[model samples]
Target: MNDIENRLKAIDFFCSGGGMSYGMLKAGIDILAGIDIDMSCKDTYEANVKNAQFIHADVFDLREDELERKMNLTKNDNNLVLIGCSPCQFWSIINTDKTKSQKSKSLLIEFSRFVKYFMPGYVVVENVPGVLRCKEESGLSSFISWLTATGYKVHFEVHNVVDYGVPQNRKRFTLIANRVTDINIIPIKQKGEVKKVKDVIGEHNGFPRIEAGHKDKSDFLHTVPRLSDINKKRLKKVSKDGGNRLEFANDPELQLNCFIGKDEAFKDTFGRLWWDKPSPTITTKFFSISNGRFTHPEEDRALSLREGATLQSFPKDYKFIGTNIAAIARMIGNAVPPEYATAIGKAIIKSQKNAI
Candidate 1:
């Protein structure tokens, strides 16, 4: 049994697929409400997390009164915490074409509006490392300044997910600010052997071999890609556990466009994951075998949605709502790994105690 007062209450913004909320809940924090623009996330958020209210509203159009009412919260609730992790597609290094979009940059300003209006006791923001390079004139910088001006002690760091026990090499920028605490908070990387890809997948965990377009009934998000005949033959020539295209490309017909180039650096393309190493970062196109180093070590097809979710630290029992692969992949890929979130939650709880 645990004491209720020690549990913090939080509202998550841009809460896609409920990863942060799931972590907070696991750490004993009560998530009061989750707000996101995506309707597909509602069922997943509400179904998996108990007592969390889901609101499908654009942050730009969200009203103070409505949010307060829906959350059963008041402006005077100093114990409340606000978590904002807006979309990072605009600022990601992978999106080199800057002209493609810059709309999500405005979301930080919108998040700041809530902080200014509610004056919550604590605030947390997580996003890509590119966010740190965004100009001070940008909305993100202004939001940071506003939090500082409000007497909050702030801590921010760019960290790899693997440093915090997630079995993937994803990096993120994390910021935690608190109005009530004077303590300096830093996320402590657990001292242990780093987890590997083989430690996470395969039949040992009850995950069976799945081909493309086939959904696992037990794990609905699990969907594997069907392999083409040419790719199958290529994979066959490659070694059993750790083979790549370089091993099978002796046949002229098996060469891909990128493989023919002398200076190409994408060696991981069409590669198999080593069972003992951390998995690569899960991306939106994770369902496609050709997207990145997503091929299964022993299987011929790309990793299923459930495997991606597992790498993202989502529990096997967690249910995603969408029927289409794109929607499901977006939800899983966009999520903050629950393990990382739990670490953040524990830190916040520690800071709150020291504040007294």
Candidate 2:
């Protein structure tokens, strides 16, 4: 916990596409490695990150001896940090099927196994807000209990991405626990106001419109959606900047299936985002017109993969790896926005410095 440069070494667990790793690297930490179960993430994680090793293995199966060998660390290494952001599909509110039977929740306990083994100086966890609401018998609760029992000072909060300057309204539960520092982990709003959708997307942003399956020449997995005839017509009818379904649906021919009866109260469906306002949270099915308020404010199609990434605060230079729209969209949607991650990283660094 020295204030000296390069005092922290971090290992990112469940590192999908290196979003957190990238931000930590930008914040001047040495990201030693990224570990995940998905083999598909290897290329993307390695391509965009610097000097960070990518391991393709389930956290449940990970062995401390193997990780230490790979990371070139021994029992003597101090100022080490372990970061885990386990998959939260089981606890996500957006998931219609809220079954507790999901095996993925077990990964939280797996993450704790590493923490107990390494007893790193600092620990960080990020997950959906639903995680904090999960039952005490659940893995998430047990993980928190384990941290407290180990005498770590833990701070956690549900935070909105917009509060940290991301152009999207994503809420997440973030926790930072440290044995070496007493610093607060909550993020301070960098600019005092959320960034607007228009502040991030469009032709000027350098992401051009591509057909649904067409990949970007430079960044192969980044692609835009092809507008269907019906949606194209619908978008044409919408007024510029912030018009939505209600404006055109007044015409009987343009009414959506959900517009009838009590559904009329749900205006966000088929809604267009105001240009000057932050976008709604980006979801896995964000490219489909019928899902959420993804429709372009002025165009006929849902927001494209590139647009979604931009809204998530990924740099224009960040390249995604994969084929097919689902693969790419899933990667983008599941990622922690880099801008928010950067804020978390900076806080961690500050805490480490203060510990000295």
Candidate 3:
């Protein structure tokens, strides 16, 4: 345990921006340390979670004992929990191309290496739903098999973030394992009514809006991309309150070339989100209207960095440190929403408390 108050110690691998750490901490777990290859996340992760240590390194380079020592673990401490959320870019159906490198596909297997070494009491894994399909042929199936063989009961399924009180329609694969006791991640009963886009990004929040490519000098990250002349004209044509480019597909002059060849080329691009519904999955390029349904319902431009983060369920105060808007967007979009992670943490705590 990290301290007297914590019932268990957790170490997260591929811990970008400390989303998992933050949520587990909220659920009262001791998130002892976090490891990631991206140095960019170091300041943000360290800045947010004071109680945990953050390590900047690839999982392949780390040894089990070194990780254990870094986490202040002893041989006798059986309450170790490991969180592995290896990069899912290669595993994502939408992102992966045939020519894309498969280097990251090995990370799931590498995570299993640590599991075998530490033999932790509890394990949590989060990734894109495509991961489940790949893992069976890749290493994830073998990993689950190993967990069951070694006395860990495992459960995993595709879960929507909105179902867990997040204000977005993002869906992901979540897995929880417990060697200390048999457990299942209880289907989260939503705290209240479904949150809507307006609920998250309504006010404009006193931050003056800027065009695309112009930085919000006053608030470092509350900035939007500068729209191109053509896109500006297109935005004018797009209807408000959940409208998209497809509304004028017949207009040859205004229709995008990419949409010309296909029967249905992602009509959601350059789309305005619905005010009453949960926002669509906020992607790295969400600041650009050319990406999926990112335009502000009433505004003529795409969402700002702050707006994107809000849609992803990051609290207003959750400071992301990065100069480039796209880089910061990547951080927010890739993160497991803190709300979703908190529910997982709560589940772990429940199982632990009920453990024999």
Considering only N, C-alpha and C atoms within 3 Å, which residue pairs clash in candidate 2? none
> Candidate 2 — worst ten consecutive residues by lDDT sum?
212-221
Q: What is the per-residue lDDT of model 1 for residues 1-356, given as tens digits with 9 covering 90 to 100?
A: 24465558999999988999999888778899899998889999998878998989999899888888777786745578899999888889877776655778777788888888898888888999988898463467777777788788889889898987788999999998887867766665667887777777788876777665576656455676677898877776666566677776567787776667642566666777778889889888777766777788888877888999998888888898887878988898889999889888888777777665
- Candidate 1 wrong stretches, greater than 4 Å: 1-6, 97-100, 240-242
Question: What TM-score would each prediction reach against the true structure?
Answer: 0.93, 0.91, 0.93
| lDDT, candidate 2, 1-356, per-residue tens | 22554478899999989888888788777899999988888888998888899988877777988887788765534578899988888878878675753876677778888888888887888888988888464476777777788777888888998888799889999988887765555655677667998888866666565444454556633556676676667767766666666776766677766675534675666667778889999988888766778877666667777788889888877888876777878888898888888888888778766666
Error of 3 at 336 (Å): 0.6
Model 2 spans > 4 angstroms off: 1-6, 75-77, 98-101, 135-137, 207-215, 220-222, 248-252
- Tell me how far the alpha carbon of residue 263 in candidate 2 is from the true structure, in angstroms, after superposition: 3.3
What is the lDDT, from 0 to 100, of the residue 131 in candidate 1? 86
Off by over 4 Å in 3: 1-6, 98-101, 204-214, 218-220, 261-263
Error of 3 at 85 (Å): 0.8
Candidate 3: tens digits of C-alpha lDDT, residues 102-125: 777788888888888888888899
Q: How many backbone clashes does candidate 3 have?
A: 4
